[model samples]
Structures are given as C-alpha cells and as structure tokens.
Target: MKRVLTTLSAALLVIACENSKGPELTGDKPPETAGDTSEGDSETGPDPDDPPVVTSAGPTTEGETDTGTTGDTTCSFVCDTTGGTGPDIQCDNWGQDCPDGQKCAAYANDGGFSWNALKCVPADAAGGEVGDPCTVEGNGVSGIDSCAFGSMCWAVDPESGQGVCVALCTGSPEAAQCAPAGTTCVVANEGVLNLCLPQCDPLLQNCESGDLCLPNPLDQSAFVCILDASGESGTTFDPCEYGNACDAGFVCQDPIFASECDPGAKGCCLPYCDLSDPECPGANQDCLAWFEAGMAPPGYENVGYCGIPQG
Candidate 1:
C-alpha cells in the first residue's frame, strides 16, 4: 500500500523519513570469498590478517561498481574519487580508509536482508547538494547514492520512488544549519534528523498568497510552506493529505492519536493550542503535550492540542 501521514484530533505526529524498514548495519566480517571450503584453508582462501583486497578490470571510476578480490573471494565496491583499491577495513573494524574528507559506512541492500561491501563515502559536502534528485540504484542499497555527508535523501513521492536530498541540521531552531534566505531549519525527525525547509508562519499567513504555513508532519511545533488544498478550507475532523491542507488555526494530524498516520490514510485536521487555554472543542478534549519534554525545543511545554491524552 502507498505510504501516507494521518493525524488524530487530540495529538498527531509524523516523521519525514519514510518507514521503509531497511536493514541496519552491524559489526563487520572478513569479505566473503567466491569459493568456500569447510576446511577454511585453500589456494584461494584469504588470510584473516590481510587487508581486504580489490580487483578491478580497469581504472576505478567514481560511482562505478568494481569487483574487489581477496584470495578467491569477490565482493563489489562502489568506487569513489579516493582512488583507493578497496576499503582497507570495515567501518565496524578500524577507522575508515577513504581519502581525506571521506568516511566509510556500511550500506544495506534494498532487500533489507543483507549489506553490500563497505565503501568510502564523502564525509563532507562533496556530493549532491540539497534539493537534488537522488535514486536508490547500484546494488539496490539505500543511501548508496547518498547526498553529501550532512544530507539525506527523503522520498517525496513513495509511489514514484522520487526523492530529494535535504541538508541535515541540529535540533535547536536557533542553532539549525544556515540555509538560503527564504528557508529555515526545521526539525524533521525530532533529534534524529533535521532539515532546511521553507520558512512559514501559519498564524500570520506569511507564506505565499496561495500557500499555507503548516506544521511539519514530523513535528507539530515546526512549520513549513506547502501548496494550498484545492477544495474548501479544512476543519477539525476533515481528512487531509498534507499538513498545509488544513485551514488557518488547524493542523492535519494522524488519526492514531500520539502516533503517525497509517500507510493509506493521510490524517484529519485538528486544532493546536497551548495548555494555558481554558477551553477545548469538546468536554472530552483536554490539552495534552504533543512531543516528549526533551524532544522539542525550549518554550514548547505549552504546545499541545485539545484532545484525549494518548496512552
């Protein structure tokens, strides 16, 4: 099913990162050999102490796949500008062997069952810049063609497999990364990931004439500019596709209450408020904290919604 964000009236949240559940990288092991024997020793057997070996038919090229051979074993390596034969060690082992300004990271395969060979990746802003289209190709691994070190690829349209590289920033709004004049840093995934998004103010309608300043799907306190919903102004309990679809003073929230939306349902619109407010939409609704205490920036304790407290 297609993935979408939904919201609950009382409390709703969403994460910018897609929940694709890719495999996580763990410890490292010696590169596998093409031929294996139970005896563990053969003419093609690799010595455990030897550094990983790489064999390429010709000169290594950046973003190109090459075969790395150690003894009889063969593994694939994505060449970078480092010009190194192969990673001298796995990221889990000793430090990265990539050239200056680059780091090593183990990338998991698209199947989410295993990982490809370790490769050197830029440790700084040497690759794709923010807002560049990126694809999950080579070896079918996520983050393979990852953006520059401080950026991540966000799937803008899951069905079309279209994504854009966004720059990561710190959690604090004031300390967030510097961005273009019209944009600001927004907390995309709480403490996990932050991104530079267009600056907007929902209350002032500071966005473009037709755009809306809506709470980020990942964090209610953070706002971003998005296109105006085509139909009538959204109200509480109205279904919404993006947070910006809601009318002024209302936000699109996941229906699951304190959780993200289900894959299909985008969510319903809800009003946000400060706990200091005296009244709510209904008697059953009460002001409840939306994010954990430490999860949000300072002065956010009063940020909440008039809704049933989530368990």
Candidate 2:
C-alpha cells in the first residue's frame, strides 16, 4: 500500500511542473533593443516632421489649395434716363450703391469690396469740350462704376475766361436736358476755364448797332452782345425791334432807332435848343435856327450844325 501511494504522489508532482512551464512559453515577449527606435515616428500618433499647409484670401483656380473659407464681392448699376443709349456697365472709382449712372468703387464702408461711380474731370488744353465728359488721363468719359481700389479719374468741365465751372449730370448732348452747352459736370475747380462776359439786361435794348444781340450763354433768360470788348458793332446785328449800327460820329441816343437821329440831333440843333427839351434847355435862337435850317439842307444829313463840339 505504501509503495502505490508514493507512485501517485510522484505523478501529481510532474503534472504540476508541466502546468507551470505553459505560462512561460505562451506569455513571454522578446526584449526591445536600441535599434528599435525610429527618428521619423512618434509614440503618440502621426509624425511631427510632416510639412505644413498654405492658404490665401485671394482668388484661385480650380484644384488650388483652399482652407474652406469665403469672401464678399461688389458691383454697380447705371442707366440713361433720356432715350439715348441703353444702360451700360462700366468700371469707375465711385462708392458702391450710387444712383443710376453711378459706378462701383472702393469706399470707407465695406472691406474694400464695392464700386465707385466715375465722374468727368474738367477739360484742360488737352481735355474735351466744356460740356463733354473726360477722365483725368484725358480720356473721354463713359459712365461706369466698379469695385477696384486705386487712384481713379472723373470727367469735369473746365472754366474759361470768366465763366464758372458747372458740374453736369446725365442728359442729352443735343439738348439741354442734362446741362447747357459749354458746361458739364466735372471735377471741382474746372469752371475757371470758361469765358467771362457781362450779362445784358433783357428788358433794355441791349443790342447795339452792328452788335449781335444773342441769348446769354450763361443765363438763357438774359440778353448779351456778341461784340468783343471794343464797342464797335459787327456787320450782322441780331434782329432788333428797331436799331442799326451808326457812323463814327453818331451815338446810340435811341437804341430802339439806333441809326436814325434823335430829336436833338446836331443836324437839327433846334431840338437840342428847345426850352422844353432837357438836353439843351437854354439854347440861343441863332443856334436853334441854324440847327433847323441845317436839317433842310440837301447834303446836311450827317453835318454838324449845333452847339456841341466835334473833333
């Protein structure tokens, strides 16, 4: 019985030893060596040595790098109220959102994405007519507005002689729908190039003999003489109710009848000598008789036979 029990104990001890070796064989791992470390890798996740990404706010083509963001844009609207040309889209340096005919341009508002309505600049020696539109670089004006940021030009009328600079709005060139001739909307200070002249009173007979009585260019309601500074009249005087240029010795005593003699003409000194006549109330009888008789003379129509002095 003793021997058999010893044999069972020995078998049990061998089984226990086998069970202990199983865990050592299955759970064991090789030791990490110094060569196992890599310079291009990180223990956390992705490698830090990778290149960075680039992006921009400006426009780009398809397949370009984009960070997935957007920007704003600006524009303008212009149209001719007159039945001339149709609406046109042009580029200019005016603020965005102007009335019709205005252009789009950069302004203080918005982040530089707007339109500016371009205006005509004044005409210089090289510029167009006073009423015609022009740009700063001497280009003809066409209404345009845009949203570009930079130095821009405007069309304007330059002043001449004595005329003032008058700004113009949209209108027809053939008619005064927008502005009068010789006048146009332009940059400031352009009116100095306009001609200066005296405005004649329309109520009076402003037309001098030989002077063309024309409508005032500045104010249509007024009258003005086309004659130059020298009072001499021109060959063709605008049709006056009654007037004509006179000889060198004659004066415009009655502008209504510019050439005909007044009652107190030197050829008829009696009128000048008449007591009731305010010109020469106290003329002598000899002077009066001589004046009347001179008028009757055949060749004395332009003769001087009065008390007045003649050079």
Candidate 3:
C-alpha cells in the first residue's frame, strides 16, 4: 500500500532542489563509495568534508559537517554545466520531503556529496556504531561524527531563516555495511514491487537492504513498502465488471472492484437478483428490491462478483 513519489515528483519528498539554478561542475573520477570515504589526493578535489559553496541551493542541513562521503555505490555526480536541474538531491518543493529509502543533503556541482559526504554504510557499519559521527571533511567542535543516510538534517532554508534538513540523501540504506552478508536491508518494498509501488513505511513495513519506508499511491491514508511476497499469501484482489450473472437481488456498482450491493438493474448494470425462487424468474424481476422486503437470505453478502451466466 505504498507509492513513491516519482523521481520527477521533487515536491513529494525533501525540498525540491532541482529547479535551483547555479554554476555546474564536472570532473573525471568514479563516484564516492557509500557512507565511507576512500583516500584521495587533495588535488582530486577536497574530500566531501570540505564545505564547498553550492552555487544554487545550499546544503540540506546547517552546520552540516563537511566530512566523509555520501551517495550509494552506483550513485555518482556529474557537473551539469547546462544547469538543467539543481542537484541529484532535487525535489519538487520543500514540503515533499525525501523519499523513504533516500535522504536529503546539500549536494553541489563540486562532487562533495559523493567524495566528501558520508559514505553509504549499513546501519551497523563502522563496527556497530549506530550514532557515531564520522567527519566527512569540515571542522567541528565535536569530533564524534553523527549522521547517516536518510537521517534528518538542517540546512538553511533560503526562504526561511530557520535551518531545515528535514531529511538527508545518502546511498541506499540496504547498501549500508550494518547488515550482515547475504542479508540485505532495504526499504519495505525494495524488490519486485519497486516499479508497481514506490516508498515504504517503516511503521508498517520493514525495509530490507536498499529499501526505505514510503506512502501508498492508492490511498495516502497508510504507509507501506515493497517486500518479497514469496512467503506471503498469493491472493490478489480483483473487481467485478458489468453484464455478469448473479444469484439474485444484487447489482454491480461503482468502485466496481470492491464489489458492493446494487439493487437497481439500470445504467450498465450486472446480474444480482436471486433466480432460485420461482416468483422472481421474469426478465423484469428486481432481485434486491424483493430480497430486501424479506424474501431472500436472512443475512447475505456476496463476497464474490456476479456468477457465470447459466443461460
């Protein structure tokens, strides 16, 4: 029951950084590793830890330590001199927030997010250091690094003076080193349902490797994530259509898939009247009208759609 905001729906998650216009940066180098940083020459570009001034929007969080690496194994940064979108951390608006599996951070053309930002380590990466802070690059009063993928951040809101990193963008959560071998930690629905559904809710679903909790598209009322259904019941829900046969006294109606009781056999109606009784045999016979008047099953609820046409 979860739907992810499309990569295009920047407003759905963290602040939309896509539209921000700024100078672009492009360099030749493999993107940074997840959560952890690899050694590099200072000329290779300062480690992501250095607080490079983002030409467009600033960092996702204020006091964001210019330290460590960011992004996932495959996620990389390319300087867009054309200035099409702001940054990969792009979002539609400030209210959309970041997607479940992903986080929001101040990314720049300088490639700091990947090279200097925190590496995408597992939740338990760094030897079970769940909250230990690792310096990506910038100096800070506390030597104890404290940030992770998807964790909240506080960047200065250009619109509002208050800082807000509501969310951060890092490599895939599952890619983090915290999880054990052969066991991937992802958002709720990270597998087969990735295309059909987006996002998962941690409260309702347990994200596996590479997965994060998100909301549902059908109804935002609840949150869910995609997961392996191999162990789950294979049952699926289908709706009823028009012109199907019924036992007696019912009709098909709107939200047709859910199946509801309809007595009127008008307006693209389906069979629902009871024919077992001899009195309701003619074509004009109204099944539900008669049944409701104390003529059929005491308490009947047709769980299934209209039955096959016997005639």
Candidate 4:
C-alpha cells in the first residue's frame, strides 16, 4: 500500500526527473531479463528493425525512446530534501510532539507539491479514524488534513478536498510498522509519508476501484495497490522510465526481454504472469521468477515476468 506524493495526485508516480526535484533510483527500472533469446520466428526472434540489447542490473542511461521522448515522469522520487515546513517549528512524525489537539504532519517547503518536511498541524478532534472518509485543506501538502493523529488523508480529490484517512507507520524508520495486520508500511515522499498500505496479490490484481497492484516503490518484495498512473499510453513494448509507468499487468523491463522492443529505449513494458499459466508474448519468452531464488515473500513465490529465459 504505497501512496506516492507529487504536485498532481493523479500524476503522482509520473516522476519528471528535473535535477531540482526527483531523486534517481535505479531509473525506476523493473525486473530484468529471464533468459537467453535464440533466433527464431517473429515472436521468438529479434525484429528485423530492432537489434539485440545487452542486459544488466543497472540504472538505465538517460536518453530518448522510439517515441522520441525523454525525461518521462511516471514514478515517485524517493527524495531526501528535508527542509522544515515552517521556520523553527519541526515535529516528529512518530510521536505526537505537537500541542494537544494537534499532530505532527508533513508538507512541501520548496514551493513544490511533494512533501519534504514535517511540522505541527491541527488534528480533527472529531475526525474519523483510520479508513474513514476524510478531507484535506488547501491542497494535499497543506498538512491541514482532517485526519486523526497517526493517520493522514489519502486519495484526496483535488477539487473537492475529499479523501480517506489512511494509517501512518508507528515506529521509527529503523523499526517502522503498521498496527493493522496484513498491511505493508510504505515510506515515500522524503520519508514524510509512512503509509500503511494494504498487501495485495499481484496475480489477482484485486485492488480497489481505480488503483492497480504493483510492487512497492521502496522494494519489489511485496505487492501493494497504487494509483493507476499508466496514463493514456504504457502499452506493450512502450518505452518506460519507471516501474509504475506501464499499464496494468505490464512493468518496465529490459529491451532484451522483448524481441520487438527498441534496444536503444531506456526500458520497455513487459507482462507479468503466473508460472502455472505462462502467457509470455514471445516464443522464446517465459514466465520467469520476478525475484531471486528464495527472495520472494510467501504467496509471491509464483509471481513471474514475461521475458527470455536465462541460461
């Protein structure tokens, strides 16, 4: 259950990588190659126009794609800019350090929309508890959310200031946790947001209405439902710069995994599948493990990506 913070909520994960803003994290590239490709038919063989690509576990080099676009902003930046929300008034998010009836919260300080600092803000004395419908004041980063202490307003409607109250992680960063069982605490937005997002199954795609199941921004070890920032494109083999830039069931993968993908592109979209039902597009592609051996969490052992098998 991760909630990425951006100037625009719907455009949250669309991380525009300007040096002044977003931090780089392996260039948001998803899982890599599954196997070696042998020359064969259209699906299994390299495309006539596209050449083979060298695969490796590293951040992609900054450049343009087949669509002739770069600086693609479609992932949350794990920023470290920690300026206080207000002058000489900082508060601890783990502890209710603010005066009674107030709570510690995060807000943007760099004239940007994402939260990078913490401060004391008024807590709704009569506000609903976790999972209750809530409202935010000013904007999402105003920190004037009408959520109870230890919770924050999430999924907010920009125009209406309406949203739901989600639980914040309880312990310190080293031992951060969610009180709710089965919930995963995702730390994002410069560590200002320690959200307790719900764990979900990647294969089922069983998230709420608009959100889609994807690996958490912090790590791919667990599955969490994040907003669908796939936008209008993110189709198969579409160039992507981040893990969340692809449409549902697709993730940004290395070009070597897909025969039709442009090797020059930073990354391309590939499908996620089950080991029992391998629906990999290419003839040489197979549903391979998304994580290293014994690295996957329980229940996620079968999670696989469509890619060429590794020898």
> What is the C-alpha local distance difference test score of each model?
0.38, 0.19, 0.22, 0.53
Model 2 accuracy (lDDT, Cα) = 0.19
- Ranked by TM-score from best down, the candidates are 4, 1, 3, 2
- Candidate with top lDDT is 4
What does the lDDT read for residue 251 in candidate 1? 60
lDDT of 2 at 147: 13
Candidate 2 residues lying further than 4 Å off, grouped into runs, are 1-81, 85-164, 169-199, 202-213, 216-221, 224-234, 237-311
Off by over 4 Å in 1: 1-126, 137-141, 170-174, 188-190, 201-212, 215-222, 225-235, 238-249, 252-268, 271-311
Off by over 4 Å in 3: 1-107, 111-128, 133-136, 139-213, 216-311
Poorest stretch of ten by lDDT in candidate 3: 3-12
CA displacement after TM-score superposition, residue 270 of candidate 1 (Å): 3.0
Candidate 3 lDDT over residue span 13-113, tens digit each: 11112221111111100111111121331221112211111122234553222212211212223222122233332431212244553322333334332
What would the per-residue lDDT of candidate 4 be over residues 1-311, giving only the tens digit for each residue? 11111101111241211211121111222211222112331232211111111011111333211111113322223322133422333877766578998988866554444454578888878877989987767655567877888898766654455677889887664566788777766554334556677778878888775455666544346666654445566778887554455766776666777788788875677788898777888768878766656666788878887877644
- TM-scores of the candidates are 0.36, 0.17, 0.19, 0.69
Write down the RMSD of candidate 3 (Cα, Å): 21.4
Rate residue 44 of model 2 by lDDT. Answer: 22
lDDT of 1 by residue, 3-66 (tens): 1222311111121112221111000011111111224333311132111211111112221212
